[model samples]
Target: MNRLSLVAVAAAVFALPALPAAAQSNEITIGISISTTGPAAALGVPERNALDFVPKEIAGVPLKVIVLDDGGDPTNATTNARRFVTESKADVILGSSTTPPTIAVSNVASEAGIPHLALAPFPLTPERAKWSVVLPQPVPIMGKVIYEHMKAHNVKTVGYIGYSDSYGDLWFNDFKKQAEPMALTLVDEERFARPDTSVAGQVLKLVAANPDAVLVGASGTAAALPQTSLRDRGYKGLIYQTHGAASMDFIRIAGPAAEGVIMASGPVMNPEGQADSALTKKPGLALDTAYEAKYGPNTRSQFAGHSYDAFEVLKRVIPVALKTAKPGTPEFREAIRQAFMSEHEIAATQGVYNWTEKDRSGLDDRSRILLTVKNGKYVPAM
Candidate 1:
């Protein structure tokens, strides 16, 4: 079975919610488990900061976030999920930036009947069942968007390479599905592992196919390999990296070769000085700007915008849930879920939030940012 197609089908099927009865009140407790200290630690640190900013009030009630570290391990995530649900007595759970941990914790959240608002982008499942809510932009939609851009530009033959894992396979399969509808051809497909130094052979293979562009879908230290490979082989095709490869590390790794490469990503930094868009004028734009400054320029990605949006969505629902239903009760969970669904036209820092049974993630073509690296600096691609 095609995993990507299954994801699309399942996401559609699981979109409906089962509303709970009556309200129970008091303090609403939420649990957050993220990789705060590990290889993927940088990804969650900013997310933790964003979740920390969620206020305890919607209608003058206190909402508290209890954080637990899973250290980027699935085992640890399961352990922490149980601890948070049992010891913390949380009504809801949020986080696990990476997919493995998110999947592990999601099982626990579902069996426990505790509502979970997740930031991981892996396709939703029945195991996530009734108590789960997805926060990040799902990759299947991202693939469609990328294919649109490619087709609009008359790009047909394309190269594909990604990490060898569940997450990578998830993204790649979707990219292929969308490409078929758009008349795009997958000329080459490659895979790599963590800490791999050379993808030069993969680059050489893809270049042999004479692809019009290349899509990179790996993150962290592994992101460097392909960029370096493209450069070493001197392939002149247009480069279209995924948001994962849009890191500052790519520029540092590939140096001059990284320039003029186009990629689809979520809002990383405000385009204040570039084109003066509405996001630049947004009141919360300063938060992202401050985040870049605090974390150093190298630590920015679509995940930051995504995780920030996750926290923001929770923040918006907490108060409404508290006022309408009692905390720690099934009614409270239903209220929060209803509040999120009822947000007809949500104005957010990332983009508008308009989720439904069809699409759990509100981000569409508008929320994505097209980026290019010029002289080791990331700037908007127009």
Candidate 2:
């Protein structure tokens, strides 16, 4: 329908970043704003790369996809969303690899009444939750699994060190929510900026507390800082990481410190390790294989799986929405939104989704899988 398939600063599956976006009257435009640089690059780069694999068209309609780099900043994310809405007239949006930026994109999408498939576990607010369906398994759900694993392993007290941002707060709150009722003491809490080179000061505080385990509530390669620092400080406690750290970069960056570190993650992290009967297993394996084939072995990121699943969601719902309204119209966008709420038991690479008008992340317990770094690779913790 249009000469270009995407508009961004980088080469894309369909179009180049140097071109202007397709003039209004989209057949079906999907705008993606992700952190392909800055702190969350580990998550966003894979997510952006996975877009290369999405079908050229869905449901007999040519789709125009536009991607933008937010660099993990909320302000940049917001500007990207505005560009999507004002320039591309995007019917749907996805993006911002980290929580704060994801929320920022969600807010912009909500204002424009576009359906947003968020890639981060952003806080659910009444207004934004209505228009946004998150791709990641919620923090509370992942936290419960980690806390249960902790309790089962006889962990009585915990310490926390994470980003000084909304994502870290979301994880830390879940840590407290699970720990307080379970009678697990929180020994210490520390925070660091995403771009900071050293978390040595925070590591010193956490090591001094010497809790039975320490949970690092950060994502991407930045999440590796605390783990490496804590081990350097000679902290002997078990280390736990949020799903945001469920990536190969953590192992690559943390090196030996990543060993014995456990994380609550999606089935996609180690798809072959999952039971064959699981609905997510096949799709997860497919994405992992495709990504590894293109990017190389052990390169699949859970963030990419989330991006893969967002396309899966569109595949299932676009046909349904087409029956109600033509693409490129607000009515069609609303139809897509309603179509998502109507569908349940969605089997995607990351998890089974069942989003509603009221809920954000529609993932169930089946979405959660535990993994630990073993011999420089991720393995089932169980």
Candidate 3:
């Protein structure tokens, strides 16, 4: 995650006392790991920045937040999670900005039995599900919107180019699942690493297939690769992007290539486009106003909205957890996990969250929106 902050947040950084047992008991600690550098920085920085605006206290207890840079590396994410458990005694864990690192963080939180609020959407195992909740819409939920949009636009065949990691695998696998039901065929598929500057080989292959549309299952500025290259290579078919590339940075980086590209994204990016009386509109707009106040207008990010929603999650769970257990204890962590499992319809900046024991990601299609880049901005598509 990336950040520039208010004084309260700076002071919170300085507030991590030496772990004196009594001091720890009187305070609640949240450990966050985000990629402030490396390939995913464009997504992580805004996530980091959103933290500055969080409440200074939770459940009437002083809150201490500690952040570590995972550098988009799962190993570093693991290290950060272990430190949260063994050192800071974090009551909960927040994130590592992208999927691979989020998987690492979730596993560590699962093993340690700490509640983890994952900023990215990652596949969860049964064990991980008990301890973690994801902030973003799950692949299937967002993929359905993309598939439906494709159906509406009369797309018959699709090509895929995505990150070679779990993120790519999840999207491609989900697309295969949805496309078949929607009568859309996957004409071809290709993959590239997150750090790769060139996807020429993959773009060339996808361009050759000449499907009705090509889906880029990638995120952040790195996603611009397939976007720019596909255009440069003279592929004129429609381009569809996963929610990961919904950030404005992707539009800027991809420039003219970004225009008319369809995106599967969270409703946070365009709250005004949401129907009136929508539960998500008020909070989504609130986050936009607060975030843009510091970051500047038209700079709001979906990733940052995920980060801001963490406090919204806490506002509900912390009070319930506090009634059962005191802060800084194993019981308290377990209680936080239970609170996540039991919390009812929570309307945050992103969407309405209604989680349960078996399904840690509770968002429905209401969390998703379709957008297209136009005139250097994202606007509702369809």
Sort the candidates on TM-score, descending order.
2, 3, 1
Scored by lDDT, model 1 comes in at 0.67
Task: Specify the highest-TM-score model's number.
Answer: 2
Give the higher-TM-score candidate: 1 or 2: 2
Give TM-scores for every candidate, taking all chains together and pairing residue i with residue i: 0.82, 0.94, 0.93
Off by over 4 Å in 3: 1-24
- lDDT by residue (146-264, candidate 3, tens digit) is 88888998999999999999999999999878787789999999999999999999988998899999999999999999999999999998999998888889988999999899998
Error of 3 at 216 (Å): 0.4
Candidate 2: clashing pairs of residues: 8-17
Which stretches of candidate 1 lie above 4 Å from their native place?
A: 1-26, 56-58, 126-129, 152-154, 195-201, 249-254, 271-284, 296-300
Higher-ranked by TM-score: 1 or 3: 3
For candidate 2, the 10 contiguous residues with the lowest summed lDDT are: 11-20
The pairs that clash in candidate 1 are 23-326, 24-326, 24-327, 25-326, 58-319
Off by over 4 Å in 2: 1-4, 9-26
**Candidate 1 TM-score versus the reference:** 0.82
If the candidates were sorted by their lDDT against the true structure, best first, what order would they fall in? 2, 3, 1
The CA lDDT of each predicted structure is: 0.67, 0.87, 0.86
What is candidate 1's lDDT per residue for 217-305, written digit by digit as tens? 77654566787688678788787776655456567767887788786665544445334555423524655666667766555555566
TM-score (C-alpha, index-matched) for candidate 3: 0.93
lDDT of 2: 0.87
